[model samples]
Target: MNPSQNEVLTPSQLIFIVNGLLIGVGILILPNSLVKITQQDACISTAIGAVYPLYICLIITYISKKHPNHNILFLSKKYLGNFMGSIMNLLFLIPFIFIIFTVTPSITNILRIYSAEFLSPFKLIIIITGVCLYTAYNGINLIGEICKIIFYVSLPLIILPLFAVQKSSILNLLPVFGSGFNNILKGSIETLYSYTGLELVLLIYPYVNDKKKIKNSLLKGIFLTTLIYVWCVFITVYYFGLDLTSKSLWPVLSASEIIDIPIINSFRYLFMLSWTLILLRCITIYCFIAVYILKDFMKKTDTKKIYFFIYPILVFLSTFFTNEITRRNFLVKVTPIMVIFLVIYVSFIALLVRIKG
Candidate 1:
């Protein structure tokens, strides 16, 4: 397991993995949150929020292509020495575990509220965590293959909105700035968490087959993801009105629920089905990243050996938070810190490599 320096995944496979991870159950909550950040120019704000991450993808892929064989862990350790590298690596790893524990409870609450009113969140949490942990234990290469399966589930997840367009009123967005242009950018940027999964490239680039294709795939990914997100936001805004869209947690699902289909019955159920894949993919991708980072640090042994130890830590830590609101609050507080680390982490590493070269 000496870094698996030769394991390189294709850019198409990487695109699916990143897309599957980014498009998650959060799609349901964003409309409401964006509105709260202030009922603004929904379409423009959503579109702008989508663009920021695309640029971020460019920066990461450029550096990763230049140093295709090295991961952030190696770069941090190399330039800053093991002590500083280990600290940053540990902080990075903390977010993954924190996310796992946080998101399971949140999805559990969603399932409880909308799908199964009586099911136990604890049981659902265990089952979801078990599947993700199993995939993660297999190592990075296998994880990429599983991502292909995730892509299939996600195909409809992206396309299902077309059926709802007929029912949407173009007039709802008439003023274009019900809340003003500046507020639109302000609100949408706050909800930019939609693009969180792009960072996975830092871990997976070391395994991509053609590092050059990584940038192209990232561009396609950000573009595709932004389009889907903007459409979802627009649909939510158009169908429900800013006030209602802002109020509902699952706005897209709610919008679909009310629209009538001729022969087919429940579009809401389809929305839920798509979201299940979203939830599973999100958790699994991050779990894979966390496990890989752990393997890199444990540097002395095979990742397969260390993975078993990692699963128990996830199970134990997840028990502290039992509700969605609390978990989301935790995610909000920690994510900005993670972003800052990534900025510093990616920049310092790139600078070090340039100096070394």
Candidate 2:
């Protein structure tokens, strides 16, 4: 494939993909975790913590806007030389895979726990790998269209709490800062992982047709996601309080479990349904980035053959670690370094783009 064959995604499609990328994986777990730290005032801590990532998005957008028709990978190669740029891309690629390995299984475990305990893990693994591979096999355009579909379906899942609000107490959010700034900041760092996927926009900026609008769209998408996250945090904290939410492994789902109604009487089922939608979207987008990063390294765009390579590698890597406890351990232990790496990675890209563009 050549430069002329490249297709830039429209700002709206990029926004759709960005929305999907921002909202998945951690949203279900992190809100509950924050309750442990934030206690009664978790909502304030969460909303305040959102600022740091939104700032990072803006900085990356600044860098992205400087390169009209290129992405971080291209800019890095231009300024840092082939070897170093490839290393940076690989750095991102590793974390991207780690994300896939960690998130898909967590989602699967949740599904098994609530939706279907009889579903075989191996069968579920194939289903996830197949969906990721299918998304990877298609080009970026199809990826965006899939995201568009995902965003609509997920809207309900993310917002389902609004329906069953009779028992919620805004007072559950009282006793502000009992945890202090340090613990709250700690929650922010932990929650930061949930919001980091918005920066995947940096990876896909090249596919956006108008570079100028990319920054605004990126921030807009992040803003909406962060807002939803804040609302969810409020709901969980208000409903469950800190002690209960902290003890629960899947806090978001736990909170959802309590929601009852004449309409459905089961929030867990709705939570699982929504979780799957975002999970599919998030995996597809990340795998696409991982495959393309490899393709850029190899100087090819024939995504079909590349998906063949990725699917097996991921399946094999995924098998080494089984059980939710092991997966959660890896995700928690490695995620901070992942965020640190991301901060540096964005700084590196911003600097390179400034130097070269």
Candidate 3:
């Protein structure tokens, strides 16, 4: 269904959207990257990385309160002027596009590895992108509702790790700071890339129905995301220790493999199936934002037509990184750059708003 252009999200919907965007494929593999950097202190890095989102949320709240009707697109043009602001707005659009490119391949590869080996990468990409396109076509309000449902449905899956905790040793988490302060800080920077979605708040701010509650809703969302990331890293480290967690590509999935459920023979498959919905939501949200930004630039274009134009390109580009190593390497190089750029971009915009006021 085509939502009205004036569609507005409630604070709870805002909370769920933030959580939905933050949780994605990052949770599945973050422990591996963190453990590689900080060893057993990976959870600490995960917790520290949360400060990035917290900072972004503060900036969003400040800017949104100051200019409730203006999204980053218009605000940039207003403060930075037509030429520079348009450049900045175009630059702002890149990360969302990168997310779609990187995550589309990553999620498809993940499903292939865990469950859908029979399916070709292109087929998987098409299926996933098709669902996302449909959702994006319906607009942000539907995406918000979907996020709320997926949040409630998939949250209980976090507890699945506890079933495997019996095999974990608290000793695995000992010598926590043994990774050293510098390494832990570096790990925090690396994990900070996983929090990419928080920047979308700037774009979505104008759509929030209860502007007064955006601050609290954003904080609630970021806190929930941080809690889950820390738990995933902590559990992975606790269960597999530094050596195994660092070596494993998808450490969380590896951790899930060990859970013994009487009803289900392989909890890993169940876990993968459940998270597939979460991953879909993550991609859909990014796709929607990308389309939304593009529509902002081309006001006369229908959003659904934009989706049709974009999906084929997403499908084709996604094929380039179907290999696991290629996909991981691309994201590793690209995501950090995107994160750093976003941080600087938003901070500069916030400063501009404050000064011009």
- Whole-model lDDT per candidate: 0.71, 0.76, 0.87
A best-first ranking of the candidates according to their lDDT comes to 3, 2, 1
The pairs that clash in candidate 2 are 9-207
Which consecutive 10 residues in model 2 have the weakest lDDT in total? Answer: 1-10
Score candidate 3 by lDDT: 0.87
Q: Which residue window of length 10 is worst by lDDT in model 3?
A: 1-10
Q: What C-alpha lDDT, on a 0 to 100 scale, does residue 54 get in candidate 1? A: 71
After superposition, the stretches of candidate 1 with alpha carbons farther than 4 Å from their true spots are 1-8, 38-40, 300-305
TM-score for model 1? 0.90
**Model 3 over residues 68-185: C-alpha lDDT tens digits?**
8788998999988899998899999988887787788888888988888999999999999999989878877888999999888877877777766777689999886999999999
How big is the positional error of residue 272 in model 3, measured in Å on the Cα after superposition? 0.5
Model 3 Cα RMSD, Å?
2.0
Query: What does candidate 2 score on TM?
Result: 0.92
Off by over 4 Å in 3: 1-6, 263-265
Could you tell which candidate, 1 or 2, scores higher by lDDT? 2
The TM-score values for the models, in the order shown, are 0.90, 0.92, 0.96
Model 1 Cα lDDT, one tens digit per residue, 217-301:
8877777777777778777887888778876767877777766666557766766766776777778878878877877667798
Arrange candidates by TM-score, descending. 3, 2, 1
Q: What 10-residue stretch in candidate 1 is worst by lDDT? A: 1-10
